[model samples]
Target: MNAIEVNVKNGYKVIVDNGIFDKIPEYALTLADYTTVTIVSDSNVAPLYIERLKKGFLRANKRVLTYVIEAGEQSKNLSNYAAILSFLANNDFKRKDLLVALGGGVVGDLTGFVASTYHRGVDFIQVPTTLLAGIDSSVGGKTAVDIKEGKNLVGAFYQPKGVFFDIETLNTLPEKEMINGFGELVKYGILMGGTLWKNLLSDNLSLENCIADSIRYKAEIVEKDEFDNGVRALLNLGHTLAHSVENLSGYTVPHGLAVGYGIRRIAKACKNNGLLQNSEYEQIINVLDKFSLTYIAPFSDNALIRASVKDKKAFADSINIIVINAIGNCSIQKFKLDKLGEFFND
Candidate 1:
């Protein structure tokens, strides 16, 4: 159990670990005496590891329920969210019950949202199956379902009891998904300096090693600031335009890819704003290129700019963007949507 404790605002401890599934019951036992467990996963992951998880929970003499949904961003909607709630309702899940989110960000977000609202909130655990979930979504406790208006429009800040990250599960991930997740790992390197960034660029580092360190890096930040009131916002390094691209792409582009392009665009924005040097921008682009991330989008500059204006991070008059001043450090800057096109044109 390679666990890093995240001290959240509501006094929740989010433990992020690799291969911790073997000790799931033991971890839950330590958290609460919940008699029932609901494992919420997607179609892709359910056929693979749901039984193993269910059996483990059953071994602890607990009643376990499994809820499987279609795997994709499109499934993260009101319909699916309602289904999860209905399942919990039928099962008579109480506050003492445990809600286990077992899949990627989509599963985690949807399940966490249900756990947050169900029975006025229940103790939940994150069994993040993808590299992106392990590194980013699972640790933050920001759960939500997407609305037609925007992404994560309906959600809450519900911290999980723990996060179990199994590196072995990542072997089954599709290459596109892996590359998409690698974009998020790179975003951490761009924001939080230290060995994590170094290991990401190191040729000798393996995916397992990167995943472990990335979880640790995020766990450290979440421990200090669970909410995005301050430093936590730095975690949105590439998310501003990424969300816009996701909306404009009609949910066709994956989150990781959109975030990858958003990172590059933000770097360009920073360079134009005199925050990042030309060499720094080149380095950012080079790393993204090395990861095979798509830095350019299919939309026109005007379309992207228009989409960005509707971003949730955008305030009344200015859009809030997280920009890297240099490698390992980042800050949020407010910019006018009209001038954003200059960054792309520049």
Candidate 2:
């Protein structure tokens, strides 16, 4: 197992490896002395791994409860959030008990939000089953559910007790979900160009190493800017526009795919504005194509801008966006709410 330590509230280790689900109880015991564990999964994942997890925890002499939500980004809403809280309350769960997020980004986000708010706060760990969650949402303590207005508009920065990545889970994912993961992988390659970018270019990377490297880079950034008041926002390299793509699609577009589209859009805008060299722009486009991340939303530039303004990062008059100055390097740029047209206009 490759362990990457993220220094946050108290600090936690992100363990990445194949078939690590059986060892979760040993890891959880180190985080806290909890007696009960509620494994919150999604419809798709519950049948596959819930029993395995429950049996493991039960063997460790811990009370185990399971709650499964409908799968998809659509499930990350206030109604489901309320339902889970009711499940916890009805079971008489205490703050000392634990919550285990046992699915992809949706399960992790919703479960993490519940852990953060229930009883003021409760202990929870992330068992991210999808590539996107394993690389991005499962770390960094950014837990949230979507509101009607926008994605992740209602949530908190509640850190998980620990995160475990079972590479085996990726095998059961649909081809589209696998594609969804590559979207974020491309974002990491662009942000930290080096071995990662080169490996992505050659497609000669091991999945475990790629995941560990991404988590390590994010760990360093989160340690530096835990509250997202500074450098950490760079992690949003393609998210500003990605969120818009998701919103316009009514979230039909998976987030990682939207992010891939976001990165392409930003790179194109930068190239036209002479901020990015043509050679680098082509490199970006090529990598995206290699991953089959060539999705294009039907919306126009003006429509994208309108949708993006509703993002949580948007201010009353301005919003901060990330722009790639070069491959592996990005900087946050402030755009006046209306002046975002610069990203679309030549």
Candidate 3:
């Protein structure tokens, strides 16, 4: 098992391995310092892993409560967040209690939001089930829920107490989910550059090593800019268009797939504007092709522009857009959302 320690205002550890779910209770006690735990999962996930966790906590002599929300992007909303906070309140879950987010990005995000706000922040643990969470969102303290206007517009930078990633859980994910994760991995490779990017171009990509490296690389960056104030904005590489695509699609588009298109869209625009070189642009398309995640957005360019303006990262008339200068190298560019239509017209 490999573990990466994320040093932030509230320091935490991210442990990655194949079968660590069996040790959730043991690790929770060590990281959270709590006797009570609330394991929040989605309906799609609880049926698969909840029983084992419930039993694990029982054998450890700890009180365990379970909350299962409907599974999907739509469930990450204010109503569900309120219900979870109410659940904790009704159960007398105090600051000392811990929250274990036991699913993909949605569960981790919503649970983290609840943990961050309920009584002004409680310790939360992440047991990421999907490749997306394990590789990216699970480790970052960015917690949020979607509003009608935009995705993740309401949230906080609440750090988790610990993150336990069991690659075995990812084995059961649908192929689409796996591809969704690859999109985020592509983002990391683009941002950090080097071995990860090289591996992506080859046929022999190591999933385990790629997962750990991405987490470690991101941990280092997050440590330097935990608040998304400066360098952290680079992480939003494809997410600006991704969030808008998701919102405009009414979220039928999976985040990873949307991100794939987001990356492509941004890359195309950058190339047209002479911001990204032709060779690097070809490489980006090839990487997307290898993953079989290429898909065109069904929404109008105008709608996409409007949705993007609502992005939380937006300031004044411009948003900080992550642009690729080359493969394994990128920069943050402030672009006017009003001019987004020109990119599409190109």
Candidate 4:
């Protein structure tokens, strides 16, 4: 096991390894200082590992409560958010209590949002099951639920007390979920490049090392800009378009898959605009192909542009877009919102 410490205002460690799900209670006890724990999971995950998690807390002499939301991106909404908040309140969960997000990104995001808002703030930890959560959302502290207007438009930057990534749990995931995760891994590969990028191009990518490397890169950025006012937005390399696509599709598109489509569109746009080299553009497309992430968005360029204007990154008349200068190198560019159609049309 490896504990990668994220140094922020309320810093915490990201623990990664096989079978580390068994160690979650121990980490929670050490980090959260809670009397009770609410393990928030989704329908897909509850039947698989909820009992083991419950038993662990019970053995630690702690009270454990479980809440299972219907599994899907649509569940990450104000309705479920309100329901979980009411659940915590009715159960008399207090500030000292802990929340354990025990599924993938949706569970982690919704739970973290609840933990952040319940009583103004409480402690929470992430035990990410899917590869996408383990590498991305589980560690970022960017908690959010979707609103009618946009994905993750309403939320907080509340940090978790700890993050436990158990690779063993990933065995239960469907092939589609694994493909979803590979989308984010491809994003990381493009962002950080070098061996991480090189390793992802191969069939034998190491999950353990890849997770650690991705988290380490994210940790460095989060430490520098925890509130995401600056450089940290680079992490949204393909997310701007991803979120827009998701919102346009009414979130039926899985986040990682939407991200895959978004990355391709942005890469093509960058190449057309003479920002990314043709070789690097082809490399990104090839990588997406290797991972089966080449699904084109059903929406047109104009529709995507309209949806993107409402993204959280939009302000006044311009929006921040992460543009690739090359693989392993990118920058946040402020594009006039009206020109987005032109940019994408290119």
Which ranges of candidate 4 are over 4 A from the true structure?
A: none
Candidate 4 TM-score, C-alpha based? 0.93
What would the TM-scores of all predictions be?
A: 0.92, 0.94, 0.92, 0.93
Q: Against the true structure, whose TM-score is highest? A: 2
lDDT of 3 by residue, 167-236 (tens): 9998789999999999899888888778888888888988888888899889988999998889988888
Candidate 4 residue-wise lDDT, 1-346, digit = tens: 7789999988889989988776679778987567889999999999999999999899999999999999988899999999999999999999889999999999999999999899999999899999899999998699999887666878999999889888899899999999999888998989999888888777897878888889988899999999888999898889888988887887688777899998998999999998999998999999999888977788888778778877767798999999999988989999988888888775
Backbone steric clashes in candidate 1, count:
0
Checking candidate 4 for backbone clashes, the offending pairs are none
Candidate 1's TM-score? 0.92
lDDT ranking, high to low: 2, 4, 3, 1
Models, CA RMSD each: 2.1, 1.7, 2.0, 2.0
Which stretches of model 2 miss by more than 4 angstroms? 337-339
Q: How accurate is candidate 3 locally (lDDT)?
A: 0.88
lDDT of each: 0.81, 0.89, 0.88, 0.89
Number of backbone-clashing residue pairs for each candidate, in the order shown: 0, 0, 0, 0
